[model samples]
Target: MDTDRLPGCYRHPDRDTGIRCARCERPICPECMISASVGFQCPECVRDGSGTGHAPAANVPRTVAGGVVPADPHLVTKILVGINAAVFLLGLVAPAVVVRLELLGRYVEYFGGPVEGVSTGQYYRLLSSVFLHVEWWHIGGNMLALWVIGGPLEAALGRVRYLAVYVLSGLGGSALVYLLTAPNTPTLGASGAIFGLLGATVVLVRRLRYEMRPVITMVVLMLVLTFVPFGGSLSVSWQAHIGGLVTGLLVGLGMVGPAAGRTRALVQWGTCAAAFLLAAAVVLVRTAELT
Candidate 1:
């Protein structure tokens, strides 16, 4: 062996290293090195000897939607709940924050205050409104639904895809509200995102070949409740619910549907992008009319 010269790492050819993998004797860099009881080993060697009692050909565990299975499957759901809770607390402390963040097309908040809303270029309200809640019952119901529906969805879809479904669903709801609802009406809640999770749940359940009765009943019940007028006051935005549901269904199809191999990720993200673009187009048309 050459004493002065060192070979490049097998994984990272650009780097020079003197250390060899304990199991395979292949030169490795610090990045590829995994500490073992005897000495450093390459990533391949470590993975092969992971002690899973399976052959090297065994597949790595992955979520249903192809995401790497995380240690804490519900971590994203918990974080989302925390964020909603914190935002709710902040809204309680400063009532004005709610007014600012809530979804409004275009309206004067006060007698002489400047107009505020998506029409006035406050586009962030589309997403921000999803987290703003004024009533305790409202936040409580949303948070509970989030925990129940979001946990399983998060576990199946993994964090990034789950979060994407959530945010896109919320935006889809906001866009519909902005387009159809009266400009002066104030709308806010996580219901749209929750509904999206519901839609995704339906798709996931179907994909997994689970029993269909429960999901069907849940969907029908939610739709009926959403559409039924309460005391002749249509305070709830059915438009948002419909929008989120449709978007979630489409994205979920892309997620767990038949697309395969290298194109799977492309299809999944493409569906998300398409949903976002459709929502943006709606916003643009609505903005033109409102302005």
Candidate 2:
């Protein structure tokens, strides 16, 4: 406590003149001093504490103008798009690739047709369908939609939750097809999941009391067009769209409203898990019928 009688610096005992490290309060010479906002500190104290003076600006989590901590980059979305692109490229290399990867409801033992006509092991098609595209243009359209809708949604939901929304939504779409559509028909692309996210966005925007009329109008228009039956060549599965959207709305019930602290996450994840399980059960029951 004596200003003038403080002991000499531990490291440089001969040079101390009573100035001390603000953090450790150890005597320090000018040589060991590093100026902080509050007072001078020693190098060891800097290393043991903030070390903030030399930290990069980019290391901080930045907040937006509205006092919102900007969410991390949508890495999951990008990874998804990349995977789709890779699969598309592989299909390009081998033309027969489509026949192997596209979703079909029937079970197959090998390169041949279904074994005894029952849906046994081909449940993977429900998932594989989300990544397959019949044409380069098909992938182009789906990927564009993904980029537009996915980034913001992933940012809002975070990586794991966003992935859950996307994958489960896709499976929900295929579940409808499995129950309602013919077993031989092959359906492919990401439209179902995209529609699901769009539907969830509408619900979330409304729940948050944001201006959502525009989003609602857009989704309605798309759904209407999906069923227009223009020349019957588009072969767009309105079933998938409806299924995904309904699932998205169901999942959003737990996610979009006022923050429930840990309860919010628990409910949101519970809703997601229930939706997935229900879809799986539907597929299982239908498969039993086929077998």
Candidate 3:
């Protein structure tokens, strides 16, 4: 080995291209290069950069491995927020449009409803309802909560895992509403996912034995506002809140627990999967009982 010779490609030692990574300045070949704003980066740099808060230049998007999908930190959270915002904008354009998007308890009512009634074939409401909000304040509150929790949790759990937790939480909440709420009542919101994030955060803190009183306090306050009537005729859906919170807790314990090592990882994901299956079972059992 020549002491002064610049290193060859880390991956392809046989081929000494002498190309340096833009971020880490490690020797790389064209095959190992990931294009960046300033210069080509090595695979490790690309992978590490995507997980960090640092981003590529405004004009250039960073991609991993094959240069196909752009690698982004907290990308899922941003997309989720954008979807909710776009749907809300559409609602502003037309009231009827928004009504159709909301989740009605009647569709789950296999038994009966008024023939030729408002209950339509919106089987997708179970998932779609998570994105629809009628009021600016409603969307605003939920989005704010998402913004608060999304970044860190998404970064920690990775995009797909975070999305799984969020979607399942919302779906669980909707199922709970179908089972518990009046058939004629309509409901929709991302509170269930938001609550799930909160629960995940709590789990993360609890496992680390970190101070989590604020989380507990916030959960308590929200519950109080949910169940206790406000301003005389104010109608709040405590059932959904409770459902979301419980689902989030189970998710937190399962997906974001403090346990360590390979065994912990297996248990964590298994727990998350079971939580989802439990929610699905609830829907099936409730539907069967009603039918």
Top candidate when judged by TM-score against the true structure = 1
Cα lDDT computed for each candidate against the true fold? 0.83, 0.70, 0.69
TM-score of 3: 0.68
- Where does candidate 1 clash, by residue pair? none
- Model 1: residue 216 alpha-carbon error in angstroms: 1.0
Error of 3 at 35 (Å): 27
- The window of 10 residues in a row where model 2 has the poorest summed lDDT is 59-68
**Reference-based lDDT, residue 3, model 1:** 66
On TM-score, the stronger of 1 and 2 is 1
- For model 2, residues 66-143, the per-residue Cα lDDT tens digits are 011234556888899999998888888885676667766774454655442228575677888788886877899889
RMSD per model, one decimal: 13.9, 15.7, 12.2
Q: Estimate each model's TM-score.
A: 0.79, 0.71, 0.68
Of 2 and 3, the candidate ranking higher by lDDT = 2
